[model samples]
Target chain A: MKYITTVNGQEYIIEIDQKTEITVNGERHGVDFQQLAESGTLSLLIDNRSLEAIVEEREDAWEVLLHGELYAVHVQDERAYRLAQARGKLSDASEAVVIRSPMPGLILDVLVEEGAHIGQGQTVVILESMKMENELRAGRDGVVTRVHVGKGDSVEKNQELIAIGDAEEIKEQQ
Target chain B: MDNLLIQKFDKVLIANRGEIAVRIQRACHKLGLQTIAVYSDADRNALHVRYADEAYNIGPPPATESYLVIDRLIDVAKKSGAEAVHPGYGFLAERADFAQACYDAGLVFIGPSPKAIAAMGDKQLARQTVRAAGVSVVPGTDPGLSDDELIAAAEKIGFPLLVKAAAGGGGKGMRPVHEAGSLSNALAGARREATAAFGDGTVYLEKMISDARHIEIQVLGDSQGNVIHLGERECSLQRRHQKVIEEAPSFVVDDELRRQMGEVAIAAARAVDYVNAGTVEFLVDRDKNFYFLEMNTRVQVEHPVTELVTGVDIVQEQLRVARGRRLRYLQDQVKLKGWAIECRINAEDPYHDFVPSTGTITAIGLPTGPGIRVDTGLYEGHTVTPYYDSMISKLICYGETRGEAVLRMRRALEEYRIMGVKTNIPFHQHMMESHRFLSGQFDTRFVEERFSMSEREIHDELEAAIFATLVAHQRSQRASQIVAPGERDTSNWKWYTRWERLQR
Candidate 1:
């Protein structure tokens, strides 16, 4: 089985011929992988060196936290990668992006209202969490399709705070 | 104070959460005193609740509805039969009204008097009081100075002064003006920010102490008018005006400087009639000139560093002072024997702009060995919510010298691990290895201006890539494995029995 893994914008091709043998980026290495009893923990021996990591599978990537660093690793097998490339959709950069609450917190302010045009990197909402005020910014330039939350509302992690979409795309959806 | 008039409490109620609550509980338990814990809905299963002898639910998670509610805390104290209330730093710790409420409820507050708290809690009032006591203050205009008056004062104070809010801390409504040209605009902006943050637009002007270090003296005063200083803690390493690291026995302070600062700190505390455990903070310039900054009327967040070096359980002393006990140690008995450093471990993403991280901590690997101490509210399977401060733990290391302490901290930071949320561990790790930090140099502005987190990534990207790929591959293999029933519908044992019967 062949897997293409992208970590922090760097891509590597990994091939697994046997349970104990693998190659990464055209470099052969003997490997032993063991999933520990602890959920999301893995002990891997690559080329006779021991390394440990906590790996969680998310919707689009396997999240790995190693050495106090967090990374979302996107791993796609050969068939899936080729199919994605063939569709001419190698990235989802131009799609609508929803500004979600990163953590449970009290909404301090909603800087943008529905139908308000916003620019990339402009703060859209301010949420008070962990004893500090955090600004949620727009990922790209677009009109706010919907304002799902308001000031003083307590929100859960991943709940939609607002959505940004193309004016035409928003109209079509409505 | 007469020994016969001692006020002893059999039980103590901790009125805060997180590591400081647990720390005070330890002190109470050490003196054979029972500890009662109060929790909000979000902290029903928190570690501090489990560590106490009794736990009471106050209210919901939001501090306003629970932790900061004086009636809820007092009710819990009365119901639990706890005679004393220890308000750990934060929450209602610095609120003078909370202290008064405790006294009104016939409960001893394990901190300064309400009068003392109020006097020191007001930033402008504290400055005036300390200055009247002959303590050197950062040359600043008095509170209630008009914008025109402030501008007038700035000219005398010289260029490069600070416009600061008189009502709050943590760098709110603070702006630095390099020249007279921008003083008016700066004052307006600061006033607006101050109004929004503290509800008080009162601002003051002060000479900005460039290249300054933050050094604070720990003071223990008994009800019998006995006061002693416990040396100093250097807390210059900061980010956005928040202390990230602290150390005892500042690299720049010698015996003479410590004595001078100690005397001035005592003078400041006495000016407010301060009693019990408190800290007098100062800003020290490069020339060793010190100025009274403020007085913290409760146990500080970085108290462990002082504990590790001085071998003094400050919380216990606070309990004793509340009980009317005389000072246990004289001023001459205090000593800063060795080097101790502490790093505040917060649940924040260091790779980003230190955004708070929260989730259930699925696993924790604590570092243990010589010279390493971890005071934390975190445990395996514990959830971290955003209803409170981001600080989850304090990691303190001690040794005979600063070098060894730094080495120990680096080793311990490397050994520490937590799962299920991002942490500022990478930031602490980077700081421990930086040459500027190891040399006992750098000031308050070092973290923001001189320090960068890009180097020393210890990039385990290769391993992360392999593990992620292997995990995906394993899941796929498991999905492809067919677990169909045996060839025959009948059970294997029944088929074997029929074959045996035919043979017979």
Candidate 2:
């Protein structure tokens, strides 16, 4: 099956056959890959050149530590890619976005209220995580349609905390 | 000479956490002394707690409520029957009050005398004391001067002066003024910063010594008035006011200068009647003129570099001195053998402005071999919390030559592995490969103001693209090998087997 892999803003088309032959970005290469049974180390021999990498599967992507640097890779199959494309269009058409927690933390305070218009970079919430206070800001000019969290609420990684709608769209909804 | 009665302690309590605490615990165990550890809520599962002979929970995660609280520390020491207290560098190491409390509690404080601590804890007083001892100090304003008086002092010091907090260390409340017009503003800013950082707005003035090397001397003094210096450590590599790398026997100091600085450092310690382990730091100029900086009243974080070169265990020496024994070596016996380098591995992202990274360390593989030592408080599945300093380990390497030491450090850094948190390993790797670093021509400002890491990232894009493709390809293979629902339920082989069974 062919896959679309995006790494650090660069996209590549990868095709694999029987786990031995692979082509990346239209260049065919004989690959010998094996996952160590005891250790999570990945051993790969691409075109007879050896490479060892530590691969960790995070929530949204695979984080590969190769040669002392971390690279985040996002992979999607054909069906999933098409589904994601559809969802992207829907979100773009509505012109609304949900602001979520970047990491697990307690809400120190909420800086915006429902129906409050906020400009890009305006503080929306103060999150205390890892013993440091981080200010979550509005990514775009919009009106806060709903606040899903309050002061002192415990939040998880990527948990949606606020809904932001276009200034005109929220008025229409109300 | 009053503490010469040979006060021996059976157990020592370490009033700190993380790698330093672990390091002290190892030293205590080596000397056959029992060690007791005190931890906050955040360090319940810490490596130090597990390494100690006994452990107690002092309080919550915040240092103020736990590590910095003299009362809590004393109570824990008492409850644990610890005969002495070792406040390893940071939390209360330099606090004179804490040392006095330990003395008042009838417990041996494994550091300099409280009087010595008090004398050197205040930078203003320390300068005066060192100067009286005939040790040259960086020309700075005296304490208790008003704003106008300070401005006048700055004028004499000339443009390019530093407004420093009298009670400050660790670069917290320092501002550099480059001209006469900005003196007042710089003073106000420094005052505000000092008030916030050290709770003292008292400011001082110092002529800024550009391109000076931060070379500090490690002094060990006994209660018998016998003080000796353990050479010097070059700690000029720094960022965000924290020393990231250190080495012993600076390239700039020759035999003649080493002897002079060593004698001056001993005099500085003797001026305060210091006892136990302490460090007298100095700033050395390009022309080899050394000026006293300050005296750390306890074991320092970079003490290992001195130990590796001098072949002395400083923590064990602290224990011995607190037990009223004289320093094992006299001035004539003290020797610097070889070169040593230390790199502090902190859980900070070098690519992202060194922001603190905290999480469970899912995996770790420390370097091992001859001439490489790793002092760390980490284990697999251990958590790196954000309540304390981000330093996770100190990797030190020693060799007969500076080139050998640097090469060994590069090899060790390459072998080190850590997962689930960002670290500054790449920064160390880059420094190891730099020509300036190899030549030993850098200052404290070299990291923050001058050094760049962009040149090291040239091959990252190509490597990342290839690795990503490989990972995707492997993942697809794994997915294909898993049996589907229809394939698991019925198979052509199974049907054929059933027909053959019926015909038979």
Candidate 3:
């Protein structure tokens, strides 16, 4: 089985075979799914040492407790995984991009017009939350493609607020 | 004599809110003084407001409209006919103008003289004054150092120095420069922070002493210029320059060293003509040499440890000093005994980068024993307001020795509990169990460097089990209480209604 894991915005492709041992980022580990189900624990061999991790099935995910660290892992079969991969490819080719709210807050001000040019790290939006004002900056130099929110808008964590794209990227899409 | 002393002023109006308000209220009641509390609209049911003989709403929730409005506070005092006002520790406590306003209004301000506060509040001037009084200070640029002069001074004093705001405290407006390459950037950063925090962009540079311990001398001064020190407190256990655990009579100090430090603190106080209670802090190195840090002109958060061992009511003494009283106890009469420790319990999630936790305190089980005391402003159903400091309580424990004190503190923590709002109590418990802390061999970076979630696997496992059990119980209860056809759903409807209420 192959899985894609994204950690801190970085992606890694991991493949696991039955009873096969693997080393990840310099740490050696052996994984056996069959043994895991029988013992209700997964035996992990790390750095030539053996450790046990408790695994439990929760709603739509597997809750794995390794050395007391709990991680909610969403597992998918081959068919569903392939569909997700296809969707990722389509999104990668699209010029329309979503900007995520960096933190939970009320949108106090939106500083850019729909077609305004924005330099990298330029403040485009101001958010007020927890009694502190934080400015959201442009991640890359680009023209403002669209504005999804307005002033006095209450937004949750990761809600889209703006869209930006380079002139070259937009022309290529057209 | 008794009749004359008790002529008037039975109730002391606490012109502040939060932990310090509760602290003053406790002290006032202990001294047979009634407490009158004033609050804003948001604090109608606050713990401090409830603990007073009378409560009145001043204004809205914002501090500028309420706490910092001197006229409103004075009006409340006058209306209530309260003679004295205890400003607690923050808000208006250290404001010299507020103190003067209280004096002009014929209300006793339970703190130092307005002159003393003004002199100490300016960090650069206070540094020069203390140094002139023969107190050793860190090698740094004096007052009125230009940017170019500051850079030159940094080069002379060497790298790894500190850039500090002259008008700031509380670990704000500070930057550490490790080398010449980072000097310009650090200075700019420090200046920006200074402006943002204190409305002052002026900063000063100092040689950052490596492996130094933070030890402060608690001093008491009277109207007659008599000042005495209450030994030294070891506040070396810090995170980001904020103290976590503080102990009195440091492990390094002997009788001779204590006497020397005490005399230096007294000299520093008298040099500024300081009156009332103040803390003269210092940075002590391994060679027994100490450099004066700064003079805190107001009451400190860690005053409980000093009071525990010395049997002195610092707040009451501050009131007496403001009333033109002489020193009640002479220098030779002061005696320190036992070991005392204080842990600042902040409403922060230790697992989540210590982010402030704001919510209602659903449940609380405070630690109580012969030697344990919790100075807190929170109650079981009180909301941990996001508009104020994250700190909710200060837990102090006293014993005959440091070892006993640590053991007692561990037990006290085990017995303590607070739900619905996250706290740093778990971190305190973990530190109390760490070998380095138990042996007193830790430094300022101990908490940051030593403890991690992965390092404490067993404790994490226990926590997981407890959380799992709690969740499972809630699920089971919900399943069992499912309403059948024709059955009333009163209790379950309450939960649903409450959730709907929050959404609305």
Candidate topping TM-score = 1
Clashes per candidate, residues 3 or more apart or on different chains: 0, 0, 0
* Per-candidate interface DockQ score: 0.49, 0.26, 0.06
Model 3: what TM-score?
0.72
- Span of ten consecutive residues with least summed lDDT in model 3 chain A: A31-40
lDDT of 2 at B280: 83
Q: For every candidate, what share of the true interface contacts is present? A: 0.64, 0.27, 0.04
lDDT agreement with native, every candidate: 0.85, 0.82, 0.72
> lDDT score, residue A82, model 2?
82
What's the residue-level lDDT of B367 in candidate 1? 86
Candidate 2: Cα lDDT at B346: 85
Considering only N, C-alpha and C atoms within 3 Å, which residue pairs clash in candidate 3? none
In candidate 2, what are the lDDT values of residues B1-504, reduced to their tens digit? Answer: 545555478899999898899999989988899999998988888999998999999999867678888998899888889999999987788888999999999899999888888899877888889899898998777877998888777778787888877766666567778898898877876676566444568878888788999999999988788999999999999885579999998999999999999899999999999899888888999899999988888888899999998888999998888898878998888889989999999887786556567778876778899899999998878877656667899999999999999999999987788878878998999999989999998987899887886667534554456566566655444443454435655543344445447656
Candidate 2 accuracy as TM-score: 0.82
The candidate with the higher DockQ, 1 or 2, is 1
lDDT of 3 by residue, B1-504 (tens): 333444246668898887788888887887788888999887888889988988878898766677778999999899988888887765677678888998999987777778877777777777788889998998887645788888888889997888887765665567778898888877776676555444567888888887788889999998677898888888888765668889987888899999999999999999878888999989988798999989888888889999888888888787666656776788888898999999888776666545556667655668888899898888867887655566788999999999888888888776666654667877787778788877777655566666663444233332223223222323334444554424645544355446546656
Clash pairs, candidate 1, are none
Higher-DockQ candidate of 1 and 3? 1
Distance from true location, Cα of B181 in model 1, Å: 11
Candidate 3 ranges with C-alpha deviation above 4 Å: A1-174, B1-11, B142-153, B180-202, B449-454, B460-504
